[model samples]
Target: MAQNKQKRGPMQFLQFGVIGFANAAIDIGTLNLLLLLFHTDAKGLLLLYNTIAYTLAVANSYYWNVIITFKRSAEGSNRQRILFIVQGLVSLGVNNLIFLGVNELLQLIGINNWLQYNVAKGMAMFLSFLASFFMVKYVVFRDYGKRYIDEKN
Candidate 1:
C-alpha cells in the first residue's frame, strides 16, 4: 500500500457517510433475513449469517464509494481494485476484533448473549466505519497513476 492522500472537501466526506449508512442498513437487513430464513440463532449460524451480511455490505460499499462518493472516472485499474479489496479486508479485521472482544466481555459480565451480540455488532460497525472511511479516502481510492488515471485533483 500506497499512502499518498489527497486533500478532500467536507462534501466528499458527507457523501461517504451517506454511502456508509446505506451499507450499514444492508448489513443489518441481510442478517435479519438470514435469521428469519433459518429460524435459528445457533453460534455457527450467527457467524455464517454475519459473514454473508458483511460481504454484501462490503460489496455495496465498494460500488457506492467508487461511483457516488469518490466520483472517479473510468480510470480505475486492476491495481487499484486489488488495493480496494485489501482495504476492505483490513476493515473487516478491525470490525471482527471489536465485535468478538465486546461480545466476550459482555458474556463475562453475564449479559444476555442475544443482546450482547447485537450491542457488540453495533459498536464494531461504528468503529469499523470510521476506520474504513480513512482507508478508502486516503489509501485505496487515491490516484496512483498519471496518464492512466485522470484522478480528481
Candidate 2:
C-alpha cells in the first residue's frame, strides 16, 4: 500500500496537470470570449468576466479532479463539497488579485492591449493553479481514518 502510494503520487500530479491545462483553456477561453462579445476592455468588466471564467473552470476542476486526479469515490460528503467551494473561492481571490495587479502594473508601464491582459491572466492562472493543487490534494480529498472524513471513536 505504501509502495502504491509512492508511485501514485507522481502519477496523480501528472493527471492533475492535464486537468489543469483543460481548466486553463476553459478559463482563458471564456474570458476572451466575453471580451470579444462585449467589445469592452473596462477594468470593472474584466473582473466580472474573470470571475465568470474562473468559476466555470473551477466547476470543471472539481468534476475531473474528483474522478480522475484525486480519485475520490464520488461526489463526496457535504463537508468535502463545502471545503472545495471554500478552497475554490480562496483560489479565485488569489487569481483575481494577481490578474488585476499585473494588469494595472502593465498599464502603468504603458503596455495596454490584449497581450497585457493575457499576461496578467497567465500569471494569475499559474499561481492559483499551484495553490489549488495543494489544497485539493492535502485538504479536500485527503483520506482520514476509514473514510475521507474522521468519525468519532
Candidate 3:
C-alpha cells in the first residue's frame, strides 16, 4: 500500500490537520453538550456519549476528507465507502480505548472534573486523528485506476 502513496505534497497533510481541527471541535462540542445535559460522569454513559460524538465527527470527516483533503474525483463507490467505514471503526476503537484508559488514569490520580475529562478526550482525538488520516489517504482513497466510478463516466 505504500506504493499507492503518490508524490503528494505536505500541503495535503496540512489540509487534513485543518479539517481535523473542525472534526475535533465537533467531537468535543458534542461530548460536552451531552455531559452538560445529562450531568453524569458514569462510565457507561461517558462511553455512550463519546461514541455518539465520535461517530458524528467521523461522518463529517468522511465528507470533507473525500471532497477537499484527498480531492478525489471518484463518484464514491460502495467499495470505497466500505473501506472508509472500516477504517473509521478501527479509528473509533483507537479513540475509545485511549479515552477510557486516560479517563481511568485520571480517576486513579483523583482528578475527576471537566478538565480531566477533556484531557482524556483530547489525547484520544489527537492520536486517532493521525490514524484516520493515514487510513483515509492510503486505503480509502488510494489510486485504483478504472475501479473508481467517476462521475463523468
Candidate 4:
C-alpha cells in the first residue's frame, strides 16, 4: 500500500511556482492594459501600477495557496484572509525594493530605458515569491495547536 505524503521543501517551492505563474500572468496582463490605457511609462508610476496589478493577482494566489500549497486553512477563514493580505502587503514592499534595485542596476549600464517594466518585475517577483512562500507557510498558516484561539475570556 502506498502512503499519502505531502509536499515538502523543493516540492513546496514547485507548487508555489505553479501558482506564481498564474499570478504573474494576471499581473503582467493588468499592467500592460493599464499602460495601454493611460500611456504611462513604467518609470515614475511603475510601482503604483504594479501594486495595483499585484493586488488583484494576490487574491487569486491566497486562495490557491491555502487550498493547494498549504493544504490547510485557518480556523476562521476571515482571520486567515486578513493575515494573508498583511503578508502580501509586506511582500509588495519587498518586491518594490527589489524591482527598483534591479532597475537601478540596469540604469547604471545605460540602455535600461529600453527595457520594459516586466524585465525588472520578473526578477522581483521571483524573490518575492520565495519570501511569500515562507511567510505563508511558517507564519500565516501555521497550525498553532488551536482551532480558533479565543482572545476574550
Best TM-score among the predictions, by candidate number: 2
Question: If the candidates were sorted by their lDDT against the true structure, best first, what order would they fall in?
Answer: 2, 3, 4, 1
Question: What Cα-based lDDT does every candidate model obtain?
Answer: 0.75, 0.88, 0.86, 0.76
Least accurate 10 contiguous residues by lDDT in model 1: 1-10
Question: For model 2, what is the alpha-carbon lDDT of residue 115?
Answer: 85
Error of 4 at 117 (Å): 1.7
- Per-residue alpha-carbon lDDT of candidate 3 for residues 94-124, written as tens digits (9 for 90 to 100): 9999999999899889996798789999999
Off by over 4 Å in 3: 1-7, 146-153
> What TM-score does structure 3 among the candidates reach?
0.87
Which residue runs of candidate 4 sit more than 4 Å off their true CA positions?
A: 1-7, 74-76, 112-116, 146-153
TM-score of each: 0.79, 0.90, 0.87, 0.79
State model 1's lDDT: 0.75
Candidate 2 least-lDDT 10 residues: 144-153
Best by lDDT: 2
lDDT by residue for model 2 over 14-75, one digit each (tens)? Answer: 99899999999999999889888896668788999999999999999999988898764335
lDDT score, candidate 3, position 117: 86
- Candidate 2: the clashing residue pairs are none
Local error of candidate 1 at residue 105 (angstroms) = 1.2
Model 1 residue-pair collision total: 0
Using lDDT as the yardstick, the better of models 1 and 3 is 3
> Which model, 2 or 3, shows the larger lDDT?
2
Superposition error at 47 for model 4 (Å): 1.5
Between candidates 1 and 2, the one scoring higher on lDDT is 2
